[model samples]
Target chain A: MVKLKGAISGLGKMGLSHAAIVGAHPEVDIVSVCDTSTLVLDAFKRFTKVKTYTDYQKMIDNESLDFVVIATPTRIHYEMVRYALEKGIHTFCEKPFSLTIREGEDLVTLANQKKLVNQVGYHNHFIGTFRDLKRLLDTDVLGDLVHFTGEAYGPVVIKEKSGTWRSDPKEGGGCLFDYASHVINLIQEIIGRPTKANGSQLKRIYSKEVDDAVYSILTLESGLSGVLSVNWSDETYRKMSTSLTILGKKGKIICNASEMKIYLKEANSKENLGKGWTIKYITDFAIPVNFYLRGEEYSAQIANFVDCIIRKSQTEINSFKQALITDKVIELLIADSKN
Target chain B: MKMDKVLFGDNQFFAVNHLSDEKSREQAIRFKDDAAIIRVLDQAREIGISTFMCTTHDRIANVCDYVRANPEKYRGFKIYPCMPYAHKYANAVTDLGIIGTIKQYIPGNIFSTFTKGGVAFIRKDFIGFMELFIDAEMKMFKGINTPVIFIQNVLVDLILGLKMFDVFKEYDSYIRKKYNAEPGYITMNLPALLDSLNSIGIENPIICSSINKIGFRMSGGINIYEKYLTEKTFRPIALQVLAAGALRPKEAIEYIGKFPKIESVLFGASSKSHIQETKELIEQYL
Candidate 1:
């Protein structure tokens, strides 16, 4: 079996998790890791034989890696991704791809030109419940889409604190990038991309710099309009929760990470769904993965990336081009907020 | 894992109802006070449940303190403390650096382990990290009777998927030697975990997993679980037997009762009637 030489930059929470996941991949060997934090790098240096470097450029230049997972903050994403694409390495970058839409657009073009496998970490698309929802939508169960709403809430910023990268707006730390981007991306993929966003308000309850909450009404490319509401200072939720509710002429569908509830006017024999209400939990339909982590979606996304690399294919459930679409939506939301 | 025939759980007290978000919110509101938790535990105790399999959440610190403060009233009561409550560690590592967090938890021997720095550190202190993490997770249950300590499913499944099966042996032996207690594992994937633990020579281990009629959260499907219950030699504790309220208590317990190999049933309920009803159903069935 051939092994892909992999290197990871940024050793934050997501970075460390990716390191562990790819390190455990049978078809990959983590040859090197780069992180500015010695506290984090010390573990790799002491525990494993994997070389550690402080400089991302040094790690890439020294290793001659087959692939790199870029988990660094948003400020440096463009340069790192461009360099990796220039080196012709398949890249797996984290979500909220870049701080600017132009940077995201440039990367999309670069990745496409380089003909490298590129996937952003939008793990929600890989979730069984959401994927099942997408499948059901494709069947036209929800007839003509009437209206929809995408929501996400969490307790990320319950207090006024700073100094971490999350507190820095330049680092893409806020409810907008950290939370709403997920909901927007999920909404864009599962439904359609929002063409225009207005009536937007970026509220700050705890954080001083970035908005702690985002509220907006969006019009999709299909002319279907919906609301995007997200807040990270919500203490009621233990962790991040994202939900989507779509209403149509025939039925209605409501989905979250754990379950999906579908309501129909009558029974659909073909779909095995009964009349009125059909509820399905995530466990009932989730596919098994060889490696499991926080959720199967995390591993599935990575596995998809690795499989894409092995196949020498570029199209993905979440390619850089698709993510840039979401980045455009985010930029419009922020632009509409300022007005 | 020797425990009561019916083990009371702490999920309700901690607002961890797995299925219904509304129910968890109600539970969070209902059990907001520590007294509410003590009241519910007393209700379970009145029903003669001597064991409480609970995650070592921050609130459990108060529960353990109460259990420790009351010696005579809670005689023969044991807690199955699940370790490294992921939320606490996730919050703590941000508040305190890695070494600071470890030192805050295990104040005694952290520096000694850190002092050994290099290949020798890798050879010995890596195990020391596991042992110390266990020690840190176990610090809350001091002086309380804990016959079995469980590693939370998150870490267990992570290690299992990583094929680091030796962590099981290290955790098993550490729990046995350091705490004089057996180590239990809680996982969503029972079959694969059983194979992994078996390969690591941890035979006939006690595992807690969901074993409902419809196989909610039962990884590898229900057929393999049935095979394990009928043929495999291990102590199986049935949890989420109600399928997160998808099935009736009577039907759930009866379905679980068919497996004579299931050693115990663990459940959580906020009300006295619900608790008593589950206990009776388990007795009538398992």
Candidate 2:
């Protein structure tokens, strides 16, 4: 099989991480890199032998790239993804597929029309524990899902940090867009689209422009309810930690980055050990991978994108259409918060 | 008449669920009997809460019935009725069409009601339509003392977002003139609503909004809400003080107690112990 050639835009933390993953993957070739800073460009110079460009459009026009990884800030995602899709390149944009729903819908339509493999960087979906939980859900082990509660807390913006675009509302700042997007994507993937959403967002300790904390109550189309509470400024959490508890008629499943516990009233399947509760750690289910930032999820997500391109198929996980639902949900929640 | 600093909320009694579907279902089943609701209210009264800030839900009509039946027991009981109980209108629209809904709620002589309804539709007089809806909502609490009539946050924020200040003026005037009640506004964004009411010359108006330590539902963030709580002229009633169960009882009441101008702390509890505990905590903290 031939390798897919790709280039990465933006040299931020996630951008550099994606570039490294792409450089290491056997089925992918890194053709070029794009960033405005010469310093960021210089850091990647010794590691990978590839041409670098400051302007994203120039790189898209100059390189014969098969696909481009858009890891830029949220404000520029619409324009970058549009240009990439219009150029008929399979695109992998970062989370928050677009700032606005209209832009996100247009990009999804363009990608589908062009028949390109489109994916978003919602890496949490590819995590082993979540993947296992999704598998468990498919088997109906937990019975009919009734309610879900998720919390994503971290110490990202505890103080008034100036310099970064993450603190600016126009740049798609706030835990709602940055952190809670992951929770939204995960919940939507696990439970399905909610019919109604009532939410609140607050800028507790961070800049006044963006929210450091967000809470939402979502009612699903299937009559199930879900709650999301995310605080990016909470000092109690060491790093970014996300936990989801899914309650069903027969049982419940609690999952986080480290472990997953399933409690059942009566075991139906033969594989079940008993009827009570079973706990599994990340070490039990996680597949060993070559690269790690948060986990193998990052590499797994990128690999899925490459496999879709190779197989000429649409991405099943974190597709542009799927991520569009998350974007729409965020918009609704923001509107509800203001009310 | 003065209201209680710790006001009992009717959300739990009406099964207005915010967090869990199962909890909501349980509450709906438990409170299916209005006697149970009255029992909780009686507990609240016994715990020394004189005011109940409640929505005009269909079940609340029964609560009013219970309150009015025993006037001797509930002699000092007052209700701050939050109006337009959006679900009622939504359920009405689902059951009856737009015109049928208006006909059902418009209170007056049939000829005047029809004339007013026609004029409202013809001239697109939203304020006139708003006044009719307010009157319809206030129908249940007619004989009871409703010292403070609130424009629900749903309509308040909708009007604020649409920049319909004239409707706010009309509601304020109608509630005061018709019921002799002080008009209050409930909103998610308190600071913004205060500014909107101030622009309309509604000075020191009563506003009920979400105010908590974690800033759970506070729209413009906690610090700005704190500033408004300190310096704003309005009588702010702090609701969602527990941040929807994020804060402990003591921490929740203590957080609100620190806010100088918060005229009241509104909370909901289904059990007697919870009600008594919450009242005791508020008294201990504040």
| Top of the candidates by TM-score | 1
* Docking quality (DockQ) for each candidate: 0.27, 0.01
Clashes of each: 0, 0
Residue lDDT tens for model 1, A90-176: 999998898888889899999989899999999898888899999999999989999999999877777775535666787887788
Please identify model 2 stretches exceeding 4 Å from their true place. B1-286
Q: Which ten residues in a row have the lowest lDDT in candidate 2 chain B?
A: B90-99
- lDDT for each candidate structure: 0.84, 0.78
List residue ranges in candidate 1 displaced over 4 A.
A49-51, A62-64, A265-275, B91-136, B160-173, B189-205, B211-236, B242-262, B273-286
What DockQ does candidate 2 score? 0.01
Residue B216, model 2: lDDT of 56
lDDT of 2 by residue, B97-159 (tens): 344445556646232646754643523445555666677778899899999999887667655
